[model samples]
Target: MELKQLEYFIVVCEQGSFNRAAECLYTSQPNVSKVILSLERELGRPLFERSPRGLRITPYGRTVREYARVVLRHTAIIRSMADYGWGKKFSLATYPSNMIAHLLADFYTHWQERYVVEHYEGTVEEVSGLVARGQAELGIVYVAQRQLSSFRHILSHKKLVFQPLDVKEACIYVGPHHPYYVRDSIDFSQLSSQRFIGGVHDYFAVEHHLERVSLGAISTRDLNYAMHSNSDHVIISALLHTDLCSLGLNFMHQPYSHYDIKTLRINGCEPFLTIGCIRQEGEPHSEAADWFVEQFRQLL
Candidate 1:
């Protein structure tokens, strides 16, 4: 029932053993067990079941784990604020592509003196989940390839807002040895016979754009999968070594132009994606969050 009890429960769930949890909490195993027993008695359900290897969370325990994570994250945020004399620490979730491309570096560089910035990288769906659950103060994501309708629906229900920052194009690229490299412009029809490496899910813009190009129109069976990864670096690396073509944000390639690669213009398709920030609608943003947004706005 107590916050400390919830903390202990989470520790046990994560560590998977009473002894390990006790060591982590810096408390005696007996005390940890007693507290867990009391918590189970109050809840009237066993939170964990012991197995040969270690403790396993029960079905009910899984539900409790979600709430426990939220509570613990918020508690730590509160404690961090208090420890810093109420100064704000901005927690942001971003996609891997944005992080690798240094999109946030300028903002962080100029604002770190005034705000504490924390960054997390994941797929668009994962980032959305973090923002929805209040784990992150805000999230930056690409909107074109993801199912924005579903995100809109979920955010509307949760009283969250998604605001557009900028609209940018993504381009297709191949290594220097590819046939497309010798041409000033390559016909889109040529792609029908080529293997295209693309993002699979939650990358709404990329996926939707590819869908329009009839990704499945080309036979994947004969197509060599150069690589399938959520990380931009991995995809780029794959394209560098093989004749495979990849779609990427235009800005992502500008910095790496020195590398040996050829960019192909896909006629009839703009290949644009919108980048934006998402946050809870009514929740008050911390000072750090406000400053970070302000800096980002200036950059845009």
Candidate 2:
């Protein structure tokens, strides 16, 4: 019924013993039992079944435990906003992208007075985890259109919400020397032997676990990976100077135009990339986060 009750209930469920939960909560076992009883009376259901050996969560308790976790997480966010001064710092995490780094740099030019601006770039999964764990105030990420349903389910289970900023059709980027440079469109089958340059943490990496689930049967492993690097300069250099190619959204065409890089559509593969920002669910965005979102939206 109360936040304290829900908090204690979750600890009890995790610890599996009232005494252990009380110790974790820095309270007495009798007090923990009293609170649990009060919560059980209000809900009219036994949260846990006690035995001589230990305690086991009931069927209803399993379900309520998840809800309690979400509620406590949101409550913590609310309290953080109230007690912690926002002017002290702002943190953001994003998937490795040049445009996002540029946007953050631009934001810094205008708002550097706000001390301790933290920025992190990683793969999609890492970005989502950062925001979910409250290590970052906001996260910018992209999900393939085909993967949106599964991605949404993952975010929901993590108690995070995603807001779409823009959607762009998928494209394969290549340099002038590449054979596909003059082509208007190419199929995924044609690139089976082509070399690729991608971020170390990107789907191109062999260690990425979500590629198959996100990209369906076609994966970067099907291609001949020439190199993997985290540096944008290194990846772009390979893409421009070698026969290597990279997968990206159509929006990248303009940015790399001066380098004579081409963004060609993949034939019969209409997969779109949806760029979005994520935050902890049920928690309102702070003023700084809103401003960053606005700037990012404008950039898109």
Tens digit per residue, CA lDDT, model 2, 56-153: 99999999999999999888766544423556677888877767767677778878777457787788888887798787889988876666788889
**For residue 191, what is the lDDT in candidate 1?**
59
For model 1 the local lDDT of residue 127 reads 78
Off by over 4 Å in 2: 1-87, 182-184, 201-221, 253-260
Residues 1-300 of candidate 1: C-alpha lDDT, one tens digit per residue:
799999999999988889999999999999999999999999999998977887889999999899989998888756643434443566788776532346466656766566555667777777777787676888877776345677678778877788877776555678875667676445555656666676645545464555444343333234345457766677667677777787655553354366776666665555357777889888887766666666555544
Clashing pairs in 2: none
Top candidate (TM-score) = 1
- Residue-level lDDT for 139 in candidate 2: 94
Q: What is the lDDT of residue 266 in candidate 1?
A: 60
Candidates in order have lDDT scores of: 0.70, 0.77
